[model samples]
Target: MAAGPGRYSKRVRRQQDILQILAQEPTMRVKALAARLEVTTETIRRDLEELAEQGLISRTYGGAMLRAEAEPALSQRERELVKEREAIARSAFRQCAHGKTFMIGSGATTAILAKRLAFELRNVTVIAHSFAVAMALAQNPTIRIIMAPGIYHAGEGAMHGAQTIRFLQDYAADWAILGASALSPDGPSDALFEAADVYGTMLRQASHNMIVADHSKFDRMATARYAQWSEIETLVSDRRPEGPLMRALERREVQFILAEG
Candidate 1:
C-alpha cells in the first residue's frame, strides 16, 4: 500500500509523514523535519533521499519539494495502495443502494468499488466509461452495466470526449461515485484534463456525489479542479484528513468517512 495504517513499518510511516508535510508546505528542510518529527537530522536526510529516489519528491539542497508527477496509467496505479484502496472500496460499498443506478468514474479506487458492488449489490445499474469498471461489474449477472461511448484513452483505460458527455446527458443516476487525483482545501481535482470533464458530467448527472480517494491525495494539487466542495456530498478515504483540508470539508458540510484498514 502507498500509505497504509500505523501497522506499516516505522520507516514507511515516517516517509509518508514527510510527504504529508511537504504537501501542506512548498518545501521543508531536513533540519525542520527532524525537529518536527523528533528524529535526528541524519534520519530525516535518509528518508528524503529515499523519497527522492522513488521520484515522489525532489531533493533541493538540504530540503525536499513535492514532485508533480504526471498521472500514472491505470495499471500502474492499481498496483499501488492496494490495501488502502480496498478498505476504502469496501467502506464505500455501504453507500451503494440496492436496485439503484450509479454513475461511476474511472480510477483504481472506483474500479475496486465496482468489483465489490458486483458481488454485494443486486439488480443495480452502473453507467461508466471505464473499461475496468465495466468489466468488473459485468461479473454479476444481476447488475446491468452501461458503457458510455466516446474516444478511448489508453492511459486511463476509459472513454472521454464530447460524445461521452453527450451520452451522459441522456441518463441520470442516484449516485455519482468518482475518484480524484488530489484533494486540497480548494476541492477535489483530477490530474488528467480529458477525464476531468467526464467526471464533472457524472456529478451533474447524479442526484448525489461521493469521492473515493486515499490519504496520499490529501493537500495535493492537480491539473483540473473538477468540482467544488459544496457539490460533493461525501468523501470516502483510508485515513482521516487533517489541518486545512479537514476544516474546509467541515465548513462545506461534506461528510468525511474514514475507511478502517
Candidate 2:
C-alpha cells in the first residue's frame, strides 16, 4: 500500500532528528543515521544533501562534519560587543599621549581604540598583529603603522606563529594595549594557547601593560592565562569591578579604570 501525507511528515521529523544527532556528533555516517532513525540509507543521503545545501553542515567522504568556520565572524562579534568595546577603547585612549609608540593586540576592543587613535592622536606609531587594526589606522599619514607577519587566524583576526614571536622580540614600545577573553582575580586569560603566547610577548616588549575588556569577561576562566594581576599596570573596563573582584584587585594594588559610555 502507498504511504499517506502523515508518513511524509514522519520522514521530515526523522530528518530533523538526524540533524540534531549529527550536530552533537558531526562524524556520523549515513548508514548510522539510517539505522538510528529506522529509515533507508537513501533517505539519509537525501537529508544530508539538503543540509549541505543550506550550509548547515558539511559532507565528508563517508560521513558529515561541522564546518569549523561556521561560527559568527569578527564583524558579528563586534556588533554584539559594541557598547562594552567602545567603553574599553575610550578608557585605553585616555592613557595615550602624543608621539608615543604603542603595541596593540588583535581584538574588537583594540580595533575600536585604533580607529579612535587614528583620528585623535598625532604623530603616534602603532605596532599591531591585527589586519583590521592596521587597516583602520592606515589612512593616517601621521601615524606609523607596523604589521607583524605570521599565520593569520581569521577568527581572532590576528597573525600568530613563530615568525610573529621573533619579530616582536626586537621591538619595544612605551605601552602595550591588549584584550582578553576572560578576567579573574588572578588576571587575564585567553581561549587559545597561541593567543596567550602572543599577549605574553606583547606584555614583555612594553614598558607598561594595559588590558581592555568588558564586564562580561570578569570572573571567567579560559584555556590559558596570559598574565597575572601584578603584570597588568592598568585595566580598562566598561563597568566597575564589584565584590570579590574589586577587593582582589585592591589587595593586589592593580590600577583599574571604569569607562563611562
TM-score of each: 0.77, 0.71
- Model 1 scores worst on lDDT over the 10 consecutive residues at 1-10
Single out the weakest 10-residue window by summed lDDT for candidate 2. Answer: 64-73
In the range 63-166, model 1's lDDT, one tens digit per residue, is 87676567789999999999999999998888765539999999999999999999888888899999999999999999988999999999999999999999
Backbone clashes in candidate 2 total 0
lDDT scores of the candidates, listed in order:
0.88, 0.79
Candidate 1 C-alpha error for residue 199, in Å: 0.7
Residue lDDT tens for model 2, 1-261: 887999888867876787678556546778888898888889788888886776665666666644332224567768877887887787788886543888999878888989988889878888999988998898788999889989989887889988999999889999998988777565687877777888999999999889888876765555578998878888899888775557768888889998988
Model 2: CA > 4 A from native: 1-72
